[model samples]
Target chain A: MNHFMTSIFLILTLQFTGVSSSLALADDSIFVIAGKNSSLPQITATDLKLIYLGQKSSLAGKPILIGQNESIQESFYATFTDKDMTAINQLWGIVIFTGKTDPPKNLKSDSEVIKFVNDDENAIGYVSKQPEGDSARVLAIQKSTTTTSK
Target chain B: MDLWKNIVFSCRLFIFCLSLATALATSVASELQINGFGTVGAAASDDQSGYAYDIRNKINYYHDTKFGLNFSSRLGQKWSWASQLLVKRWVDDTFDDNKVKLDWALVSYHPWSDLSFRVGKQKLPLWLFSDYAEVGFLYPWVRPIQEVYGITPLNTITGASLNYIKQLGTVNFELNAVAGDSKVVEDRNGGIVLLANVKRAQLLTFSLIHENFLLKANLGKSDAVDVTQRTGSSSYVFPQLKYTFASLGAKVDYQTHFVWTEIVTTHVEHLSNMNGLYLSYGKKFGIFSPHITYARYWSHNYKSVRADTTTSTATTTVRVLSYVPERKNKQQSLILGLVTKITDRSNFKLEWQYIDADGYSRDTTERSTTTGGVTTTVTSHGNTKERGFFDAHPRGEVNLFSATINFIF
Candidate 1:
């Protein structure tokens, strides 16, 4: 009886933890920034998908370079595109193996992402939406009501 | 041939180094990035069957080795070029003089996000990767399955291509149109002719994403002609759709594959209707990726016809000759392969394939001739039929094992 109760408790606690972590991530903000300090056009989710897919090489006449944490590729897809990590990876495989284009360069952390994006004029990258300081600007929230318009 | 192969190999190396030195020099002078890629490998069929019965009839499948070099460079903002050189033997005798030759050369221009164009000598883009089929680094296998891509004419068109990109609600579409003339080469029947010519091909591809699902399809067509032959023309319509997913670690776990096939179909010309399909599953464990693929190819069935005439008359005797048409050609193969990433920019692969061919017949017709003082009808059809039961090539069934190493820098 005691073992069964312990098992139930463990399961409930793990489930709660998963839900809370997701909720926490939802509360966090994702920042989109350009390589230069010049005012850049706000990017929509649709454009974001295009850039990653290699379908669109540039934005506003400038080539866009996207840098994301290696692990974040899956997380970003799950949250933004409603796709499991596997589907997104497979999509990239098909493109890369076909000799169409190169895969995006992976970075270590959020700070590196900001530095890289802020350094290159044609660069575009992402970070935690709710970052601390004014290092980079948040282009738009993932699937938020306000981001629906241009 | 050996001497020539050595010379060509050295020349290729020299050119490769020269390009590298130039790229490095330019990298120091400007922000432009230069990279190099190549695949150097060899394949030998355990079965002695030649590339075709006519060519391989005397020498068998292990005539010699196959080697190639591919190089590419990025010129500047939106211009690039690439080329390939291949060296192989058609028959065992060096007198046959197998040598190295330029396969393709082209310049690519991308002006905007919505448009890119390529002009010069380029591979006919019949399928998704047909343009880069010989570039092993870009594909998982050492070579494409012969049953499907094998029959596609290996022609280089000198022309231009236009590519367009469009966005739908939740999908992206790539539109491409290519126009050019096919390269001329020696035909299989020891005749000179053009494999493809004055060709125009169009590709329409769309990718869809619904939740974790990914779906894609490509459709294309080509119209070409054989100049040397007597009004020989070629036409093809191919379509392929695939859905893939990643399962373990960083691997594409499954692929749902399908393809439609047809070649030039005409009575007077070379009429061939062949289709191939493959289902593959791949897993990537770090740098090593192992995949097993099952593919099949089949040609349209042909019926045989025979005519006979016998007459005897006292006042008037008459004799006639009749011709019967028949179709008897069928071939299939299965390939298993494993590719390992030796380094970040290098890969090595080993593959084994089983090939089976049947319904091969030699000419057997009778002719009436006058010998001495009497009329006689003689039949001539007594050629030996070679068979391949094991992986050896004396017969039709055989195995092909090959290893290849590719590098990109």
Candidate 2:
């Protein structure tokens, strides 16, 4: 009976490790989609930050919209900028105080961003995962991973 | 009844215009945005025996309060506008001298990706950070070295400027040209004087930056149309370099440190040549920062002409003394400062400085020798080689303490 219990414990531990590893890999793989009809070159993390902060005057020498979906963009912001929602508000406060720039236009959905970008050639935005419509294309992918040690 | 209808119509029109402006700014103008910054604080110096001396002689003394606001915005494509307002006291006994003043108002334009143009009143781009030097939030010090930067004019220009910036791999080059009229009127205790002159300025800089290393060379020249100005036409050149080493998860939170040194040579066409050297070292933590700076200024013939008047009815013949209006002055100072970030939008800083000056005195005459029962008289003139009853002046020392709060919204 003691031997039987030991074998059962080993089986459960192996299964749990496999499941957790796959979950970590899945967490790292992220999908990025453009708004409606933006033909911007693939974006890097730096480019995304610049566009959202309204620092990039134009994309490829052409002006682009600095619009984003509040909820979705908020996630990307927390992960990358260390500037969560509170930090974002403070950043805007500085911008307003300096009288240098204004807060970006916030949209509610991926579709709205798509429509806006599609309507203007200079517009650029992002959506979670790959987009389904032909009006836009995938920009890039962001990956994070977890490591476990015995 | 008619007036009521007109008022309602005006109100509606105003609301509609406001909405339309907001909509267009958000949808159409990708490059335009308006932002502002402000700071309101009280400053008091415990060193009542001495004065609070900034790089520019003395900015304040005793207990005083100062407040300032700045507004800047980018236009649709290439244009931008900026303005600043400040109120502070320059009084020795009290804060009654507080007055509001316009610090800057300028319009800037970018003609090309590598070239920018600016017109109207603009800040002189003499140093690397001159463009945003006044704003305290961006810097770790309560104030930059005032003596080195204070002598330079703060603002003047009713003309235009052209700037070119280009990048070749890791190296960036910048060139600027300014032309037009530079006139300033300082209103102090109801006394006013107008400073006018035809002005011209040029700035050339070459910068090479790589990750944690930065190197730069700056050369500047300014020519005044006339010699009536205190800071006559002068040429200034300096070179500086800095190395920064910091990364994530180091034993030290900031692990980054930088050391920078610069030497500036100032040559006024017909006057004296003032040479200055500045050295600084700084370190940063995740939130805390500390820096130390040292500067030395020396002039051969420190002839800062305070008054040049011609008396019509002179009793004696007009004669020029061999050493007239000649005096040499030297300044040495050390500053220790700290910066603390309270929140994302709020920051505060405290700093202390020690300044010493030597070789500043007027010439006086005394007895040189007495022989054969006859006393001989000797004349001691300013900057003269003759030593007649010479007296050494004690070194002037001053300690300064100041604090400031900065916020943006």
Q: After superposing the true interface residues, what Cα RMSD does each candidate give?
A: 7.5, 7.3
Candidate 1 residue spans exceeding 4 A from truth: A1-33, A37-39, A42-50, A60-150, B1-4, B51-112, B184-224, B227-270, B285-288, B300-327, B362-396
Off by over 4 Å in 2: A1-35, A46-58, A63-120, A123-138, A141-150, B1-32, B40-75, B78-102, B168-174, B185-198, B208-216, B225-255, B258-261, B302-324, B363-396
- Model 2 C-alpha lDDT per residue in residues B1-409, reported as the tens digit of each score: 5466446545544554464457446744453333334444434333333332212233342122344455555565566676665545432222233445565676777655566677776565455445555556655556645445543443445667776655444333445665555543322211212233435654554544322344555565555533232223321221111111111110111235655565655555444556666677778664566888897767654333333233222332222222224656677888888866655556677788776656544543333344454545555554433111111222246566677776653
Candidate 1 chain A TM-score vs. reference chain A:
0.68
Task: Give the candidate number with the greatest DockQ.
Answer: 2
Worst 10 residues of 2 chain A by lDDT: A17-26
Assess each prediction's global lDDT (C-alpha) against the native. 0.51, 0.50
Candidate with best lDDT? 1
Computed on C-alpha atoms, the DockQ of candidate 2 is: 0.10
RMSD of each: 11.7, 13.7
- Chain A TM-scores of each predicted structure, in the order given, are 0.68, 0.63
Compose the digit string of candidate 1's lDDT tens values, residues B108-201.
7878756778787766555445665555665677766555565445445677777676656555566666666554443433222323343453
Best by TM-score: 2
